[model samples]
Target: MGKPPLSGIRVVEFAGIGPGPFAGMMLADHGAEVIRIDRTRPGGLSLAIDAKDPLLRSRRSVSLDLKNPDAIAAVRRIVRDADAIIEGFRPGVMERLGLGPDVLLGDNPRLVYGRMTGWGQTGPRAHEPGHDINYVALSGVLHALGRAGEKPTPPINLAGDFGGGAMFLAFGMLAALLHAQRTGEGQVVDAAMTEGSSVLMSMMWGFRAMGRWRDERGTNLLDTAAHFYDTYETSDGKYVSLGAIEPQFYAEFRRVAGLDDAKWDRQMDQGGWPALKDELTALFRTRSRDEWVALFEGHDICFAPVLGFDEARADPHNVARGAFVEAGGVSQPAPAPRYSVSDTVVPQMAGARDDAGLLRELGFGDAEIAALGH
Candidate 1:
């Protein structure tokens, strides 16, 4: 295999929480030399085992006190040779630290400056503090989730923090890198979780416009309202999901499940969904989840048994594909979207490093390194 696609690319990530580290992890996994500049004092929303945190994998760390001018100068020196920089702070925070886009981009015109935030750089709530739930709530995602006549359930932090925030930040930085390569002009990527999450609901918005989706939560086809498209609990107290939306697939599902009632004929009859769903709920409880899985093993009914984290890691298909790997004494997902030619680097644990040695490699003389107290 060839060298990784981003073998020579350098990314400087200002350490923050959530989406910033996740974006850095993606770039590092794909073979970018991601250097994370962490705070000299450690106090933030960090896990107890930060060294084994999957989001911080495949990167090196450099702790620096941003309040010190010498540390700021060192960061500027580092940014001068970097292709991109990622920062996840509220508006003007970087400027306060003297590491804003204007200063860095003025020095390196080819740099891609990526900014991650809950609200965008400019908005009514841009400077306000918030988290994943607030961002998704503002984006109409939270309002559309959960069961009928129930409160909206938060999908943890996936939809807002990682899916909307980190993924878009990574994509924007890569796109801006391409543009910088072509024009030699650096630009800032203002990636906001609110806007990104809103974009994720584009299909739902279109469905609403086309009169295919209802305003009520959990009333849509993809939600939990459809009798043929939902999860059911089994006798073993485990769950299995069914998404047999197509006519042929639904028919196959009914045939396999032994549903000979004439009422199962109309699959899309929303008015009869509640009663049909209750019937399915009662029917599924008659057998164990694994028994249902065995019965549907060779079928195309869009069925899958819901598995927990450990079960997912130990699944046969996951084992065959090497989807999860053991690294740093922890089981975690492997780098995704494989490349035929370029190689992906194995993830490593994040921990303390030789700061002086790294500085020397960056062309800092022994005296200057000592002066910076590295």
Candidate 2:
């Protein structure tokens, strides 16, 4: 196979939690040389960086005290040779540390400065402290989740943190990198979880605009209001998801599931959904999850067993596709979006790394490297 698409690119990551490291992981997985700037002393909300942490995989790390002027200079030198930088800090935090975009971008005109934050670089809430739940709550996503009369259920930070924040940061940085390559100019990518999460609801927003979606939680077609598109509990207490939205698929589901009642004929009758769903709930409970899986596995119905993390790892289809890989004695998801020629780099375990080699590559002399304690 050819080299990964990002084989020659270099990135300087100011490590933090959540989206920042995830974005760094994505870049490193694609074969970019990502050097992480870890703090000499653990501070703030930063978690303990462990070898088992998949997000911190595939990157070399350098420990530096940002409070020291020497460390700041070392970072500037590092950025001079970097193609991009990833930092997840609130507004003005990097400026206060003298590592803001203006200074770094001036040192390297083609540097893609990627910033990750909950509220973004501006707005009244920009400086406010927030988390994934808070960001998604403000994006109308949390309100749209859960049952009709129930309080909104948070999707455990996936929708806000990784999906909205990290994914957008990665996308923006790559886009800016392309622009920089073409025009020899760098730009700042301010990826806000709030804005990104809002963007994620574009389809729902379109449905609402077209009067096809209700503002109420769980009352919409795709939000569990439809009898043919929801999860059912089996006799063994395991769950399975059904997404037989199309007419033919739903018919196949009914036929395979033995739903011979005339009430199942009018598929789009939303008013009868609750009763039909209740009947399906009882019918599903008559069989075990495995039994249902065996019956629906090869059918036209869009059905799937709602497997837990461990089950997902051992699933036949996932195993066949090599979706999960063992790294650092931990089973985690593999790098995604397969390529025909370029091979994505396998993930490496995070651990202590000597910065001497990397510093020398960035043009640091022995004396300078010694001063930096490499």
Listing every candidate in turn, what is its Cα RMSD in Å to the true structure after a full C-alpha superposition?
A: 2.0, 1.9
Q: What's the lDDT of the predicted structure labeled candidate 2?
A: 0.91
Residue 140's lDDT within candidate 2 is 87
Clashing pairs in 2: none
> Against the unseen true structure, what C-alpha lDDT does each candidate score?
0.91, 0.91
Candidate 1 lDDT at 186 equals 93
Query: What TM-score do all the candidates reach, one by one?
Result: 0.97, 0.97
Worst 10 residues of 2 by lDDT: 40-49
True-vs-predicted CA distance for residue 343, candidate 2, Å: 0.5
**10-114 per-residue lDDT for model 2 (tens digits):** 999998999999999999999999999988754422235798899999988887778878889999988998999999999998999998989999999999999
